[model samples]
Target: MALATLGVVVPGIAAFYEFVVKGRKRLGYRVQMDTTATNVVETDDPGVFDQLREPLVDPTLVLLRIENNGQTHIDEDDYAVLHDKKAGVTITFPDRKVVGMVVTELSDDGMRSSFEDGGGLAVKGSRILLPKVPMNRGAHYKVLAALDTMNGKMDQYPPPKVACTIKGGVTGGKIQETRSRTGTPKRVIALIVFLVAIVVAQLVVFTQSNNGAPLDCASGHLNVTGSTAFAPIAREAAKSYQDLCPDATFGFDMRGSGEGLQFLDQAGRDGKADGQLTFSDGEKPDDMPGLLPRPIAFFLFTLVVNKDSGVADLTGDQIERIYQGKITNWRAVGGNDLAIRLISRNPGSGTRNAFQRRVLGGVREPGTNSDDCRNRDPGSPPGVVRCARDSTDAVLRTVESTPGAMGYSELGAATGRAGLTAIRIDGHPATVDEADHGAYPFWETEFGYTAGEPAANSLAASFLRYLTNQVGADIIRSYGDRPCAELANPQLCRPT
Candidate 1:
């Protein structure tokens, strides 16, 4: 009888440790500071109000910190409130009315837009409402609001209360008060607790594990198409995903981003959108109705030149002048005296769009005048010869073999090619860290677009989930791209 009891209780404890203790997702909050306006007014001091407005009555200010103090990410869908109840979280001040509010601080500057109007931030009577803001692990923001008495009485009221009423998904939906930290000690404590829990759990139970299999796996044939810049990542990720799910298969159509999106648009119209998807170096066109975009990563691009050119860095002005047909020779830009050859991509390429938007300052590149990338076409007035390539690999190859040739390619694709150098812009190297800090300018948010939202259990959705998860993030980072999941400013992943 005692053995039977131990068997059941031990398994229950192990299950609890696995799901509740180790893998739990939590959202925590803390009221760091609260003060009433009346407390600061002295006997003879003027009240806290402008002459143009009514004087504040028992007006108070609150500093509230909300964070994803969880082991996993909290996505926008995780917020239980949706449809009719649009606010994700609600803060109530009993007997008080909210006058104004502002976001005081954030873990990432990318979060700033979330607090603006139309982001679902609203004030009604005594309640402050917030939109369904997605937060990565340890991401946080602070809200500062001014509150006044609703009944015009100067009497003190009860403290404010936060109710995380919309609890849905795997996350611990409710936001509860937690201890405020001013430094890194909170991380230290969390680490120590995690270590202790792991040791104790191992000692108490011998549990069977699934050997690191994916929890979300769907089997189906999916068609993928997209930017040549992003094709390598898509192919590699698809192969790995197939390894895990034997029944799943993927077909690729390596076309430019615009072409892929066009295909997806037609697929939607034909009722075959569920099994088709495309990846782009940037956002798809607005005219492609019914397409849903999921951000993937921040991909960096670089200007590559043949080593014989001897040019290491070019300023933004020089680049613009080059594309503008003003600078024609390598010697004009501090390089060897070789005639410049410009290798460009077709207009349909998303890489070309990003290059024009980010590096060319919203200007279009001059039309291709050379078919072979070696000589200009008849009747084309030229100082430098220019041509277009259909794929990233072709661009790299062309730049490598032609002296004084210059072209742009995805950072990963340009890293180790022979006879070519990945030149920097304004002396800043193409790196994720540099791009995140505004030092590098040739980066764009990568996106995955579908005709419509795939069913939760469909292969299209599961493959996307895999690309954004930890395993996929590791793969993405290995190729010199920064996955959206790890961005401090997640908003950067959203196409502008």
Candidate 2:
């Protein structure tokens, strides 16, 4: 029995040695190195690794069939690939040392069998396999392999070391060339769009700035139109105001007072005029629209004659008779025997309205041959030796130069002229003090009109306010006109 047990043990030991050791010797393996197309390869003058050192590397998967060059069969389940870091790996070379081999695994049925490079159990009729590895262009890599048996026996073999240089940094070079050719057009388009955006933003800012101070008038012009009699006074006030507000501009035009009302109407419809001046003929005209009534000064319409004429005063009835052609000769009104030359404003003038209302009782019919003694009509009239002047200046000149002539003008123009004398009206002297106190009977107010609310309170409005103030009253008095108290507040002009 002892002899039989010894025989069984010996056979078992002998079988294990043959299958695990001798069988593994027949399987030979080696490693190969290749360079990628994109990177440069540099090596030290002296070798950096010995044949006995284990190769350290980053191994990429490859797809290839490894033919069984010896008589062995490789198993599929006996291997794995490992890395210093499991997910991905990097290999660093210090001082550009010469590289040995990059380690990788081999498999029997296209699957890795062990972590060692070129490791596999092979049969003479079978082959091992690997998957392809990808690399950067011009990059160099080293590779090696090893073999192992399941029973702990292992062997490593070094393949011939070879060197190769990559010709170009292929991927990086292509990217740089593409950028160089296409950059200018894109940059120009971007710059144009940026500039356009900047201009639009600046315009928006300018508009907002103007909107904040629309009424300041620091950079604008204002225009006033209407009553010729009021034109000089308004112009003087505007000039004085301009001295205080240098950035503001002002202008005026004298059409007749009726036309002034029409201009007010037009301003209401189209925003044309900034102000209007008209005489009060007892009531405001219902036909005029959008008028903003404000009293700026008082004008007394007095009959003026050449200083050489002997006439100094006329009763209301005498003046009516003269305008009606009842008293054509100057001798009738205590003047020279010369013919009484009449200078009158145009028919549409508010001055004409005021004259007719006060003296002729609104009678305006033209006399027949300066002999008709009746007030036939109040809208049309004739005078002997009529000088049809549209403005106060013309009326004054006609009265001053013509012998035995009489015409009406505001007190301002009637005074200080060498050749004209103002006549007394209804036993009351036509004086600025009388007009200011309302005792002179021809006091009236002026107005400015606008459409709805103005776009904003404007410089024109400021000027109007100034014209009503005390300083403005002094200016008015200087011009031979009464201050605006009677027109502004009749109560203020009541007798003391």
Candidate 3:
């Protein structure tokens, strides 16, 4: 009875093993495998070795080998890392497709294989001793092995290809081969050439447009030189005009009215410039060329003081006294007892010239008895405070910092300084509206100067039209300047 039981148990165990091993093969179930094919395989069918190949999907590892072929030792810096040392490889596929891939490597016994995100396609280390587990069969594959260096220098390498096969008891395997693609380099070169041609063409267009017909009503580059007071308004106007006519450009220089007139006078005689605008107080200079044209825009010069000076207004006579070195203390002007520190422009300033002509009536000298003025002349009379600043920004800086300091500046510059206050002139507030309506006592027009009538219908004319337009006016106002139309008595042409 014991012997019979043992025989029955042994047969049953053998049958169970056979069923587990061969069940899927007999049923003809296909197994989808990973790229390495190292994982155990399973099947629904009991039996079937017939394999179908799926195209090798996107690869993760691409090995590249670069060879110098020359005998020179290459430095490490000569080679650039791929993707800036990030984990990507460059490769060519068996189908001649080129791609950069990311992959993982596994090694055993001095042999290596790579795995990527794609389906089960892998390169085995040794073919004879270690047959590849089959992926879906018949798929083509190519893999770059690794980056290699010649003479200690790293470089790129061509990839290797492999075909899938199954033989004998081995259900899957990979075969190594080579692949080549034609015309790829030529295509890349052609693309680069096309891009370069486009860039050159654009450059030519830009150059031609910039150098086009001068000032022919189309608006070319206009050189504007005159009062710094007018510079902000003119600059804003030029920019606005350029926006309207993109091809036109304007150049402005903030030379004083005298310098502008001088340039215009010279250019007029030499037939160089087209128009002239002078911001003089209508006391036209004797030497000013009769041919030069007149003003275009009027601007005002006003006295600006420290906001804490407690002075809000001044009469012309009081201003004369303050600038002439009469009033040395703010208390005299209804303010605290701080010593008045007066600031004035350089003698050559158009603003200075205009102030002398209008406010001083050309009689009172600036350096008379005022501590603010320092005498360059040995026997000169006492002078007003000589700030000797170069630009409006400089003058404002002094006024804002020096307690009880008073200076004259363009209304635009004085508008927003923290410590500065603009005084009402003769009871009328210094404002854009007042200046526009001619109510502001300090209001005046600015001018541009050119030699002759601008070349018929040139860029100069276009620029002038643009300056007078609503758009340009809007920009001027935005910059704390009254627009040209606003300065007009009727004030009808409002900025749009």
Top candidate (lDDT): 1
Kindly list the per-residue Cα lDDT of model 1 for residues 296-339, writing each as its tens digit: 89889999999999899999999999988888888998899888
The per-candidate count of clashes, in order, stands at 0, 29, 59
lDDT string, candidate 3, 330-444, tens digits: 8997888777777777666777776676667675445523333322335544444445565677778888887788888877778877788888877888666776665665655
Misplaced by over 4 Å in model 3 are: 1-219, 274-284, 362-365, 368-384, 432-439, 479-496
Give the range where candidate 3 is weakest over 10 consecutive residues by summed lDDT.
25-34
Error of 2 at 280 (Å): 8.2
lDDT (10s digit) by residue, model 2, range 360-455: 776884523321212223445554655457788888887787777788877776778889988887677876566555556554444444434443
The alpha-carbon lDDT assigned to residue 299 of candidate 2 equals 59
TM-score of each: 0.59, 0.49, 0.49
The 10 consecutive residues of candidate 1 with the worst lDDT sum are 203-212
lDDT agreement with native, every candidate: 0.79, 0.49, 0.49
> Candidate 2: what lDDT?
0.49
lDDT of 1: 0.79
TM-score of candidate 2 against the unseen true structure = 0.49
lDDT of 1 at 59: 62
Residue ranges of candidate 1 with Cα displaced over 4 Å:
1-213
